[model samples]
Target: MIKKLLVGIVIITALALAGVYYAIEQAKSYLQTPLALNQAELVTITPGTSFNRAIGLLVAQGWLSETPYLRLLPKLYPELTNVKAGTYQLVAPLTAYDALAQFTQGKEHQFTITLVEGSRFSEWRQQLAQAPHLTHQLTELSEAEIAAKLGVDREKLEGLFLAETYHYTAGTTDVALLQRAQRNLERVLKKHWAQRDAALPLRSEYDALTLASIIEKETAIASERSRVASVFINRLNLGMRLQTDPTVIYGMGEAYDGNIRKKDLRTATPYNTYMINGLPPTPIAMVGEAAIAAALSPEQSDYLYFVASGRGDHVFSKTLAEHNRAVRAYLKVLRNQ
Candidate 1:
C-alpha cells in the first residue's frame, strides 16, 4: 500500500512539471519565432475600442493564439492598451508581444485620397461614402448634413480644399481631414492675401476665392491661370458682367449631370455670374494656392473674353467683336459635327 501511494505521488509531480514547461515554452515563442505575415493586408481598428475587440482583432489576424493566452497576454503586459488604431502588416514568428509592439511603435498603413480641383462637395460626399479607411458613413447624407457634421460649409469648402493627394492612417475622420484641408487653405491665403494688388477691385478674400474658383474651372492650363484671372479682373474693373459658365453650371445644382445644357444657361441662381453683376455667392470649384494667388495678383492685360476651342486651351479676345468672331468659329465647328 505504501509503495503504491509513493508511485502515485511521483506521477502527479511529473505531470505538473511537464505542464509548467509547456507554458514557459509557449511564452518564450514570441522571442524565437520569425514573423510570417503579409504586408498588403490592412488591419483597421477604431478609436475607443474595448479590450474584447482588441483581443478579437488579434485572434482574427492570427497574431494571438486565441487560447487563454489572449486574456493572459494583456494581463501580463498592460502596455498592450497603448497600441494606436491603424492598419498594420501582420507577419509571423511574431508572438503577441511582438505584434503588439509593432502596432504601437511601427509604421502604420496609410490610405490615399485625391481631392481634384473643381470637384464639388456633393461629389466629395460620394467619394467619402465609398472610402474604406475613413470611419464615417455618408451615403445617406445630404449636402447640408455633411457640411453640418464635418463643419465644412459646402460653399466654403468649395475651392478651399487644395487639389492633391492626401495620405492618412486608417480610421481617420472625414471631419478631421476636411478641417486639415481648411487649415491649409487658411495658411496659404494668409500669406498670399497680403501680396495682392491693392488697386484691384476685389472686395474681400471671399471675392478673391470666388474669382479663383472661376480661374480653376475655366482652364487646367497652368500658363492660362494669370490670363484667365486677368480677364475676370478686367471685367470687374470695367464693371462688366463676368458672364462665366461655371456659375451657371453651379446654379444647375442637382440637375447637372455630365453634360451642361443651353437651357441651364438661362436658369438663374445667386451663383450665376451671367445674371449677377458681381462675384458669385460662393466659389464654383476647388482651387489650389496657385490659383488663389493668380486671382489676387492677376496678369496685366487688356483681354476680357475667352472662348474654348474644343481643345483643352482657349482663345483670349480683347474686344466684343473679336470674341463674337471666335464664338462663331467654334459654334461653326460644333455645327459641322
Candidate 2:
C-alpha cells in the first residue's frame, strides 16, 4: 500500500512539471517568429490606468498573439509589476509573453521641438500650440498668467532660454518646459558672462545682453555680428541715438506694411530707435548666447557708424562720410537700375 501511494505521488508531480514545461515551450515558440506582423504604432498610456487595460489595448490593437496569456503574464514572469506609464512604440505581431516583457521594461516616447533664436513671443506661442508632444499653449498666455501658472516672475523672463531643439515626451507642460528653457539660458549665460573680457564698459550682464539684442537685430551675417557690436558700443560711449531700422519695424506692431518707408522712421514710439536714446525698454527679440557674449565683450574699434552694404553684410565706418558711401552702395543694390 505504501509503494502504490508513493507511485501515485510521483505521477502527480511529473504531470505538474510536464504542464509547466509545455507552457514555457509554447510561449517560446510563439515569441520567436515574425509571422504576418502588423506595423508598429504609438500607444499613449494616460495617467491612472491598470495593467488589465494595457493588455486589452494590446489585444485590441492586434499586437498580442494570445489574450488569455495576459493575466498569466505576471505569474509566469514576476517583472510585470515594474511597468511604467507614458507613450510607447508598440510593435505588432509579438507573442503575449514577449510583449509583456517589453512593456514591463518601459520604453518612453520622445520628440524634439525647437525654440529658434529671435522668435517673437507670438511666434513661440504658435509653435507651442502646434507641437505634438508639448501640452501647454504659452503664446497667448498673458505675462501675469504665465507667472502665476509657472510660479515665475513676469518681468524677469527676458532671454531666459536657449534657442535650440529640446527633447521631450508628449504632454509636457508648455509653461514648465519653457521655464526649463529659461533656466538653461540663464545657466549658460552666467557661465559665459563670468569669462567675459574685463575691459568692457558694460555696467552689467543684462545691460550687455540688452545691447547685444540690438546688434543681433542689425544684421544676419555671421561675420557682421562683431562689427555691428563695435558700432553700437562706440555709439553708447558717445551717447548718440541707436537709430536702428529694426526698432522702427518693431514699433510698427501689426500695422507694419513690411516696407520701411522714409516716413516710418519718423514715427514716434518707445521702440523706435530713431527717436529713442540708449537701449530700448525691453529686448526687441530673443537674442542667442553669441549675441550676449558679443555684447559683453564687444570688438574694440573706433567705428561709430555702420550701414548695410547689401549682400546680407554691412560696412563699418568711423565717420559720417564713410557711412554715407556705404549707404549709397546699399541704395544702388536696392534700386538695381
Candidate 3:
C-alpha cells in the first residue's frame, strides 16, 4: 500500500511540472508573435486611464480583437498599472508584449511649435490656435483675460512670451505652453535687466522689452541690432521723437493698408512714437534675446537715425541730413526696382 501511494504522488508531481512548462512556452510564443498592422498608428492615453480601457483602445486599433489572450493580459501582468499618459506612435508588426512594454515605458511622441521673433502677439495667437493636438483654451479669451487667467497682472500680452521653438506632448494646453514661454521670458529679462548698462533712459524692464521689440522689427540683420538700438537710445536721450515707421504702423492698427502715408506718421495715437514722447504703452511684437541684449547695452555711438539700405540692412546716421540722404538713396533703389 505504501509503494502504491508513493507512485501516485510521483506521477501527480510530473504532470504538474509538464503543465507548467507548456504554459510558459505558450506564453512566450504569444508574446513573441507580431500583430497584424499595416502601418504605424498614433495613440493617446489620457491620465488615469485604466488597464481595461487601454486594452479596449488597442482593440479599437484592430489588434487583439477581444481575444482570450488580451482578456488575460491584465490578470497576467497586474504590476503594469502605472501606464503614463501621452501621445505614442505604435509601429507596425509590433508584438503585443512589445506594445505593452512601450506603454509601460511611456515612450511619448513630441510635437513642436516655433514662435518667431518680430511676430506680433496676434500672430502668436493664430499660431497657437493652429498648432496640432494642443488643447486650445485661449481661443475665446481676450489678451487681458488670458493674462488674468495666467496670474499675470499685465493689461497687454505682447513681448511676454519668448520667441523660440517649444516642444510638448499632444494634449498639452495652450495655457501651459504660454506659461512656459512667459517664465522663460521672465528669466531672460531678469538676467539681462540686472546686467544692463548704467544711466539708461529706460524706466524699467518692461521699457527694455518694449525697446527690444522695436529693435527686432527695425532690422533682421544680426550686426544691425546694436546700431539700431543705439539710434533709439540716442533719440530718447536727446528728447527727439522716435519717428519709427513700425510704431506708426502699430498705432494705425488694422487701418494700416501695407503703406505708411505721410498722414499716417502725422496722425496722433498712443502707440505712435512720432506723436508720443516715450515708449508706447506696450511692446509691439515678440522680441528675441539678441534684441533684448541690444536694448540693455546699446552700442555707444552718435547715430541718431537709421534707414533701410535696400540690401536687407540699415545705414546708421548721426545727423538728420545723412538720414535724409540715405532715405533718398533707398527711394532711388525702390524706383529702379
Candidate 4:
C-alpha cells in the first residue's frame, strides 16, 4: 500500500509541473502576439508619467482596452516601469514585449529643425517658436534674458548659434535646442580656431566667427567664400575700412528696408563696418562651417573689392580702378534689368 501511494504522489507532482510549464509557455506566447490598433497614433508620455498611466491611455484609446497584457507585462518585467517621457509614434500590430522595450529604451519620436545660414538670433527664436513638438520657453524672454538662460556669457544675442539641422525627441524645450546649437557652434569654432592658419587677422574665436558671419553675408557662392574672406583680411591688415554693406544694414536694426542707400552706408554705427576700423562688436548672422573655415584660412589673393557681377555672382578686383569699372558694369546690368 505504501509503494502504490508513493507512485501516485509522483504522478500528481509530474502533472502539476507540466501544467506550470504550459502556463509559462502561454504567457510567453501572449507577450509575443501582436495586437493591431487598427491605425497609427501618436502617444505622448509627459514627464513624470507613470507606466500604469501609459497603459491606461492605451486602453482609453480603444487599442488595448480589453487586453490583459498591461497587467501581466509589469508582473513579468518590472524594470519596464521606467518608461521615458516623450512623444512616441505607436503603430498597430506592436507586440507587448516590443512596445515595452521601446518605452524602456526611450525610443521616442524624433522631430527636426533646420537653422539656416545667415539667420539672425531673432529669426532663430521665431523658427524655434514655430517648431512643432518643441516646448516653447523663450517666446517671452528678451535677448539678454535668453543669453543668460542659454549660459552664454555675452551681451549680444545675435550669431550665437550654428546653422545646421538638429534632431530631438518631443518635449525638448526651445532653450534646450538653442543650447545644443550654441554648443555645436562652440565646438566648431574651437576646433577650427585651433587649426587656423598662422598670422590671420582674427584675434580670437569670436573674431573669427564675426568675420565668418560677414563672409556668409557677402557671397552665396561657395567658391567665392575664401576670396571674400581674403578681401576683409587684406583690408584689416592695410588699416582700411571693411566697407561691407551687410554690417551697416545689421546696425540699422528695424530701420533698414530692402535697400541700402548712400545715407545708410555713410551713417556710422557700432556694427557699420564701412565706418568702423575693424571687425564688428559681434557676429551679424549665423555662420556655417565653410564660412568659418574660409575666415581662418583665406586664399592668397591681392583682391580687395567685390561687387555683384549682375549674374548672381561677385566681381572680385585687386585695385580701386578695376573695382570702379566692375561697379559701372554692374550698374549698367541693373539699368538694363
lDDT of 3 by residue, 1-337 (tens): 9999999999999999998766666655665668667887788888888877776788787765555454555656766656778888778778867776777789887789999999998999999999999999999999889999999989889899899999988889999999999999999999999998878999899999999999998888888888889999998999998888888898899999999988888899999988889789899999888999999989999999888888788888898899899999999999999
lDDT for each residue of candidate 4 in 1-337, tens digit (9 for 90 to 100): 9999999999999999998776667666765767556777678877887877766666677665444444555666678788888778777679756766677788987888889998898888788889988899989988888888888799887777889999998878998888888888889988889988868877888899999999999898999999999999999999999999989999999999899998888888999988889998999999888999999989999999999999999999999999999999999999999
TM-score of 4: 0.82
Off by over 4 Å in 2: 1-19, 31-40, 48-52, 90-102, 137-140, 148-158
Candidate 1's C-alpha runs over 4 A off are 1-39, 44-85, 90-101, 137-157, 257-263, 332-337
**Model 3 misplacement above 4 A:** 1-23, 33-40, 47-56, 63-81, 91-95
Q: What TM-score against the true fold does each predicted structure earn? A: 0.73, 0.83, 0.85, 0.82
Looking at candidate 4, what is the lDDT of residue 277?
Answer: 95
Model 4 worst lDDT run, 10 consecutive residues: 64-73
Per-residue alpha-carbon lDDT of candidate 2 for residues 1-337, written as tens digits (9 for 90 to 100)? 9999999999999999998787776645554534234677677766755667766676576655453444444466576556567887656565554555666666676778888777666677678788886776676667667767767655645454566778887778887678778787787678767987776656676667667677767776667777788888778778888888877887898979879988888888888888888777766776777777777667788998888777767788889998898899899999994
lDDT of 2 at 322: 86
Provide the overall lDDT of each model, using Cα atoms, as 2-decimal numbers.
0.76, 0.72, 0.86, 0.85
1 against 4, candidate with superior TM-score? 4
Leading candidate by lDDT = 3
Q: Comparing 3 and 4 by lDDT, which wins? A: 3
By TM-score, the better pick of 1 and 2 is: 2
